[model samples]
Target: MDNQSLNADILILEGLKVTPRSSIAAFIFLLLMYIFIMVANIGLVVLIFMERSLHQPMYLLFCNMSVNEVFGATIVVPHILRDLFVSDSERYIHYIVCVVQAFCVNLYGGVCHTILMTMTFDRYMAICNPLRYTIIMTNWMVVKLSVAAWAVVFVMVSILLSLTIRLSRCRRFIDNAHCDNASLFKLSCEDVVINHAFGLSYSVLLLGSSTGSVTLTYIKIATVCLRSKTKTINTKALQTCATHFTLYIILMFSAFIIIILHRFPHLSDHRKMVSTVGEVALPALNAVIYGLGVRYCIFWYRSDTK
Candidate 1:
């Protein structure tokens, strides 16, 4: 047999598990969720782009997050639904395609985490040092921060992709609903030491720094709130932080689920599938919580620029 025929079996994704009876239900559920998520994310992106009043640092940071939401979901979900609803016989994704999907998921997610970090700092400045916020978080600063987020993710995930993609496949099964770096790594028969080392170190550096910075800033903001005697001041402080705080919670929880899924393989495939979905796609959930809940959105249509 030629090389093409010999390597054919190794390129397949065999871990997708949906019972034939449930495939229809799964397809329907995922389709609906994907549509809702896309619409919400797209709407947010367009709203930010159209409204000049919304062209502040905070909205720019959130615009990056919202765009990533759509990008990540598009990378993962449509394929999943296609596989579930259409590909009854051949459920295997090509290995190269899988690698690309895995890369995009991480890239989008990494950028979102960084954007949230920037957003929290913006909040800290706005609430804790309202006078300097405008001077500090200028249009150029916002653009640079946004560009920096994407640049960091691009470099790190490129390293991860380099380390993981060349490994020899021991198995084709992925054991989840979509392609993930962890899922792909587990299939490799070769030593994944480099992948594990670089992936872990990079993840810790990126997430840990963001988490610590955001936490410290929020703590400072809380102190500022406490220092103020006016009840309205405290309420406003809490309100300003509310959406970003909620975004942090949701992103962190999704990350926690990914960790649990990897650390404890004893968990059912069903659970892994759910956690997997939560990781790559949350625009619908976030739209309800952040977009609708934030007061800025209420003023999106108003001609007054703050």
Candidate 2:
């Protein structure tokens, strides 16, 4: 096939092979899942903004995290749901749409990790140095950090997409339901050593830094817990850090599992399902954790006011 011919207008998504009966079930389930994700995450953000008392640095960061969850899930779940109802032959996406989706999906991931890491740092400062927490984590500082996180992820995703877009695509079939950096670049007939090198370096740097930050923060928190003679400090630390840690673990575990699944081409469907579930479910789970934590705090806040 000639390069021009291979530059088709659409790319086939061969991952979501659903029977007529199964398609209906999957569509309903995903629709409900996406709805819940939107409500939970958006609801948290709205509540934080409405309540004046919840305008602390912690809640502000939670608001940012929830917004990020919404961003990530929106980039993926609707597309998957749409693909489910379509016939096998019609299960294709536009060439430009695919590239845009790939960019947004990867941007979601990079930003997600950055926000989570920022939240961890917030928790560390709040717990390890209560006296200086307010001084260090002012609203201005949170805004700066949030802006920096998005800016960093935006640049990284742009670089990765630029590399893929430069490649001469000689294929149009992606074996998964969604477009991503790996699947998009693999469609090219040209050598992709640079792509692979940059992708690996990107993942390693982001994941390693985020993981290392979480680890060190928790170790410091643990140290504080051990020497603290007061139950009040330990309880406060647990309340502040528990939800953030839960979210960190869930996101990292889902991400690592998907990465491992990609290594085995034979489990394309398994990989597809895992990837879809991760993208959809992780946001919902994050919102739920944050909602519960916020509820607990609100209970105390209300009690104090009463």
Residue-level lDDT tens digits of model 2 in 185-278: 8899999999999998999999999999999999999999999989978987888788888888888898888888887999888999999888
Highest-lDDT candidate = 2
TM-score (all chains, Cα) for each model: 0.89, 0.95
lDDT scores for all predictions? 0.77, 0.87
Q: How does model 2 score by TM-score?
A: 0.95
- What TM-score does model 1 achieve against the real structure? 0.89
Top-TM-score structure, candidate number: 2
Clashing pairs in 2: none
Q: Go through the candidates in order and give the C-alpha RMSD of each one to the true structure.
A: 2.7, 1.9
**Predicted candidate 1 versus true structure: per-residue lDDT over 1-306, tens digit per residue:** 787655654445544477889988877877888888888878877876786756778777877887888888888778776776545346777787888888998897788788888888788888888899899999998988889889988998888888887787778777666777888888888888888888889888887988898889988998998898989668756876887788898888777677666777777575568664684457778766656643455553362445
